[model samples]
Target: MVDYQIKIENCNSIDCADILIKKGSLNIKYGPNGLGKSTIARAIVSQARNDGSLELLAPFKGRGKAGAGQPKVSGIDGIASALVFDEGYVNQFAFQQDEVVKNSFDIFIKTAEYEKTMLEIEALFAGIKKAFSDNVEIEQTTKDLKELRDAFGKTNADGSIAKSSKLLKAYGSGNKIENIPEVLKPFESFIKSQDPSKWIGWQIKGNEFLKLGDTCPYCSTALPDGPQKDIPLAVAKEYDANAIAHLNTLKAVIERLGKYFSPKGQENLEKITKAKLELTAPEKSFLSGLKTDIEALIAMLEGLRTISFYSLRDVDEIADKIRLLKIDLGMTEKLDSVETRKVTEPINAQLEELIKQVGALKGSINKHKAKIKKAIEENQDSINSFLKSAGYKYSVVIIPEPDSYKMKLLHKDLAGHIDSASKHLSYGEKNAFALVLFMHQVLSDNPDIIVLDDPISSFDKNKKFAILHELFRGKASLRDRTTLMLTHDIEPAIDVIKSKASAFQGASPSATFLSSKGGIVTEVQIKPDEIHTFAKICTEILSAPGDTLIKSIYLRRYFEIMDNVGLAYNLLASLFKKRANPTVQSATESRDMTGSEKSQAVAEIKKHIAEFDYDALVNTVSDDNAMKAKFFATEVGYEKIQLFRIIRGKHEDDVISKFINESYHIENEYVMQLNPHKFEGVPEYVVDECSRLLKTA
Candidate 1:
């Protein structure tokens, strides 16, 4: 394995972080909550994709400055591509409608082998594609097909015409223009001209003014006769300008494309346009049937021109489809244009070529079908199994598409498939499912590096370990890849590197504690031996050099853990409440701790701290001035918390008192807390709250 040092500078909270990551290993960066782990994940991803968003990571102190500090990531040249599972990735890709993940087909199916087989099949169909391209008539043939298809409306069926049909709007029962009336025969030349729709519109506009009076509304001439009144009624009886314009457009299209139609089709169309009245029912049926024929021809031609592996999935079916492209020879015979013969001749030849090649195409596709099928089934089963084991009632099924596959999410209580997974899934469920899917995606892509930034910290211990095992400890998992898992919770590191190390044999897991100070981040290797129980940690600290009050705090915790809460625990707790040699008062009697009780507690405390003196520890915590001085002088967050606890003894402020109580008792039996070796384990905000409360006092 090669070790690479990744140096990041001036990015977010990290000023400089020189981290060593080993290729082909699972490297975990473990730290407390605010050590810039997510920022590092984003920075590395930004550089790997070369998306130019790395400048957005410049630290807030250096923002809006010209050339002040440029965020840079070095030593990642070997990482050509990386898949990171972060909060942003989860929100963007997981819990999509109709599927658990947005491009599930690419992650679960389409391997390098599948793509290669598809390319071979495409090459086999190249002959048919080239024939269509070489013939220059194919473009016009498509246009001719579209022109006839538009004349019959959407369904191309024998029924009442749709209101939106171009043919219906132009030449329906009341829409068409018939012969001119005898009253307007004087202007027959203008009415029968090449363009009469505009002139008809002008005449109709002039007729509207005749309603004003018996006199002429336009030129102020007298019109008291009956014949002039009949002029307005005749003008209003004609078709509107839009209907006339549509009729003109239809006639022009038919004139250019009619030669391609059969004799019966051309005759029926001419009679419809030339008739002086509405068409008969038989005539409408003829046009609808003709429309169906034209639509089928267009579909056949277009389908054959672009054959691929998806088209030839079933050999017999595609062979039938290709043979159907051969139209009747009589249709071509009526056309005088050379383009018709050019198109029909090559189509017949390619029909033969396509029918002959179907067997070979089927063989090529079948060669890879087993592998692709297995991949799809395994992916579906893997995700569903994860959901089951992790207490999620949802499952995924990979449905096949024409050229790919789709993975749809299903719920046990819901009907059919869920179309909106994001709505049904909780926030944690979404995050968990996204993490597992991301692991599968990393396996599919086989990128150089995989980064999981604080992925499983949101889960409980049971689910956290379940997800970790699924991600790094299976046959088809990210076991030996170069993976970086950054987390604030120590559970993953404890489980992967220590508790369950044998479970993940090939993972090559290792961890480092990340800590930041003054915008500079650093890491220290956390050996398995360094992770200890809280009781052992308390003992280790009590044995070292430190303040007496801090040692008493650890002693109190040890007594609580050891169940020795009778004399020693209560006495130390009383001292913590700012009382020295405390008294116990109940409904019965009030009494001070006698010399014998003090000696007994002192003796028990000295077992852990050899120099422990009861009076000295009590006196150290009782003096508020000395404890406040220690709180200001100390930089360690845990120490600050303890000193604040001593300084704010029995104060009536419930908020600060509650915070101190929780912080004091947070280290329980099950928690795997890191030793604060030169770094603060508690958050700065907790210590700041303590400092703020004390300063007011």
Candidate 2:
């Protein structure tokens, strides 16, 4: 069937879409990337593998209810198989040439780019395959961490972490000093009315005054060396012994609390920081905040110590400060503590998963690279033949090195021994290699349909022309087969239309463009390029208001192909003369004829169009006259053509009208001017007339 309609729903970038390919062979669909071009290509291949498996038809990525999201491919009949060549197919067969790493930074940048893609792939997998829920868990954990960090506190206005002070006394009272209690007892009565808290403070002041000797507040000693000779030697040992005993007791309590405040308590935070894990913004800030608090708490504990003599107030202050610190340090699980293993254990588990998944992604890519090398080795001869035919000079030869697997591109030398293809081939050359691989396995094997997406990526103009010629010219040109090609490059597409201009001399090239509007793939009408048959030419000529020159050229050429140029010309010229003015063919004629010209005019027209008296070419027994008569002929040569007319009747006015209009418009335009560069080229009247003629023919 020349016409095939495929309905694509939720397929990759396409939402719910339908594209009608009128004449399927050598069709080229044009669109931008992410516009469902590749989606449609893969869908065709998937359907070929299993028409009934809707799972294959499912879009590679999209959002919807699971099964409901599966794309539906309908109305494909006799499309036995559609093989596809795309970036994905290329990656399966080719590799970059080994090169020296002159710059380490470049490798780092590429690795980062690769990592990003790997993450994206994992996320996609998480969505498609339920078993790959690792990313899902990471995402959820990250989200939870975000909420927690926001609840903790707003960050300092700057992005940098607020540096916590190392000074222990930055908070609470740390003014009390270790001193002898007996030295202060002598002054106890001097401040007897003072409360115990006040008395302890006054007594400490009294001892400092005594250390001054004559100038000290109590003894009023002026000499600095005077107090050294009379220092209380006997009592010092007793105080020293008491201080050591008290130190042991307090140290034990301090040790008990250190487990919760020390770096040991912040194991998860340390691990996350050391891993330099690339978590979300909130997660990073949250961990940083926790680490800062741990450091501040450790600094506070450094100031706590016991003395030989302890005042009641100092002891209470120490106890009260420690309790408050425990709170600040997140030691109490009021709701949930940040440093607690329970809070961070799941996150740590998720972090481990990130590592595993990232590695898995890298492994998967490497595995594909290796597999391509193996596939090339296995299919060398066939692939090389396909390449040479497609205009490449090289043959693929895999050189097995124990250290690494690599493929060498080889070409024949004068002496007949194959040598390396070249020092380096451009990116386009490698892409050509990929196309050759595809052509060998798919197009050369006679698949009913071949869908190539962006087939000439990175291709220069010369390469583009070579590819179009290699694929579309001579016997290699797709004939009696439906080839669907899509590209984002408009220039190449225009060239392709121009290159195939001759083979479809009297027939329209089955080329159309697809545009995505609101995620739907809609066919944009291609004019003049598709106008290719006898009826189309007559309609366009009859309908034109200004210029019918191109259509006239088309009419002559089409009749020539049917071997009826002179005979059909004679009849049409007479009909127009008999009616005076040519009218658009219709059930109700567009207008009544007014006699305009005669046979002299028809003969003059023949002189303008005859191009060496084509009538001479049409005078054989079953000549142009007989062929022209066969349009109304009931027998053999015309049955298939007549059936197309009957099928035209079965469709709605819109479909039939579109088909013929494009056919006539494209064919006529190509004949006169290969480039359809301007608007107002063909009038509306011609459009309707062409539809009318095709319907009748």
Candidate 3:
């Protein structure tokens, strides 16, 4: 810790913060979310930045505090510089769309000048050899295999099939029907037996053959005289009833099923068949399986069409076949799934060959270490080694190249393509990357003072632990720099404060509380936390003097483990009470007396808010009406229902979003200004009274 004394007057939140931060001491400052823990940390950095040498942010001079002409910020003398990781730093380096930070580079003698004499270049290489004697093997390969895989065309199928090519050019091409249905088989047999001419109806002659009266119309020829004589042309109609009726029915069914065999429908079937073949293994199997039913339906239609008119067979199958086809068609997807297949082999083979060639080059060329070009090709070896040692799950390395160095994050995706560090990294991974570089720069520089404002804001639990261990576990890394870590998170804050030691030079830590109200900051004293068991250290620090804003948050953390929300809310209500007027205070106390526990609580909160009586906010949509619309029906529908929306309280939400829209507000927004810690020459009583008011919460 770079020992520095601090005194603030009319700063962002600190009305006056006079404290001596000893050197090499683990000093921690914590508060509740939205209460500007970052403010105090940045204020310290701003003081260090004021020495006129560092191009840094100016200290905060309380803009809202009245009678604040100029701030009297002091006690920052030998502070050379400050390494701060605040919002500004995160915005500039962590999440912008820019080239990812260099993590690795190479060793080579590459000249920047476009043109040079052969002898001049030879002299340069000779000079490199003279300076560096150790041979270093630098492998040139693709940086990110995963990204390269994406760069390869998305299309995979060969598209070389003759049918696909021909069908696309002409829609009608290759259009054909499937197998004729079994239902048509009997009709085909009946059609072959047709001998309608042999029927007695053929012999019938004369108008109606006497309306087919008692006599056999064919034998009417026996009556040679009158109308019946001389073999009257009017013969009998023998088979007309059964054979003609069946034939007509067959014809009707055939017409109904004919659409599948039509030119248009046949063209579509052909497309389906071609698509089936083009699909990936699974999709091809699925489409092929559907062909059985399709073929059976077509066969049924064909059988119906070929039915004989003279003889009858079962045409009962037509309707059933048509129904089956309709059912199948309805179930079929509008678009068939023809997944992709690799048209070409993976590029791994080529990459492997290139790697081999590089190996060969090493044998031919003399192995020698060269002056690494920091300007042109940055050396990320330091960072890469640190990250790898820290258990990063990638074969990260840096290699020298012609103009710039290659940062190979050597890990392939399922498709065997290496992943890009920049192009498509996840949010968590990006956070880790940015933080690693930030720490590397800070520790490598060995700055006198380090101010990290919620550095692990985007980190996971495991990552948070890893960083904490690295910073506080040993004295070797931070032996020279004074570290002041600021966080609203209780766990980490506990860790830093518990590690407090006079071996401040060693592995010990100290802490302070920065409570704020209406954007004015004040440091309060409860008790230096009693030395307690490691398990109880968090509770101890939380007990230290600070605003109820922080204490309420700490209580919430306790409730998470304790599972006593009622107690947590009661405490939270107390914190709100600190800022609430008498009416609002009375409202918070009106919890459920009998049946109206949660409902009463909500009404009281809403009622207190309504007292503000902002017409615009009141006219806004009603949370009650919205609650009824979204969830009331659900409650009635279920057998059991929860009485309270236990998660609906203002701060219960994990995602820190939105202002609570209450007259009593907690200040989360922060501002930075220069010339912090300005001590004003006010009477002791006035300044003392003001300080009491600031810490009263």
Instruction: Count clashes in each candidate, considering only residues at least 3 apart in sequence or on different chains.
Output: 0, 17, 55
Which ranges in model 2 have alpha carbons more than 4 Å from their true place? 22-24, 51-69, 94-409, 412-425, 474-477, 503-508, 528-697
Candidate 3's residue-wise lDDT over 1-697, tens digit each? 3466677554444455565566766566654455545556656666676654211222355345665544445677777678876656655654333234432221112233212322332332342232222222101011121121122213225422222222222211211112212333323333234443233234333436645554545445434446434223322211232333333333333334333233544444444433412334443333233333334433432322222211111223332332332222323332122210010012222223333343332322222222333422332544444445556654444544443444455543333324445555666566666665566556545677778777775665567656665555532245445777776554554444443333233545665555554445554421235323322432543545532323333343344334444632443443333312112223356442233443444343333232222222222213434333333332211100110121133332222113222101223312111011121111222223323332342
Which parts of model 3 are misplaced by more than 4 Å?
A: 51-67, 94-392, 403-407, 412-420, 474-476, 497-507, 517-520, 524-697
Candidate 1, run of 10 with poorest lDDT: 331-340
Per residue, candidate 1 scores C-alpha lDDT tens digits across 468-496 of 88898755789879889898888888898
- Candidate 1, residue 57: the lDDT equals 96
* Whole-model lDDT values for every prediction: 0.76, 0.45, 0.39
What's the distance in Å from true for residue 441, model 2? 2.4
Q: How much does each candidate deviate from the true structure in C-alpha RMSD?
A: 3.8, 22.6, 27.6
What is candidate 2's lDDT per residue for 47-123, written digit by digit as tens? 76675655654555654556566676775666777677777665544444331111211221223444454455445
lDDT of 3 at 83: 82
Most TM-score-accurate candidate: 1
Model 2 Cα displacement at 158 (Å)?
Answer: 86
In order of appearance, the predictions have TM-scores of 0.88, 0.32, 0.37
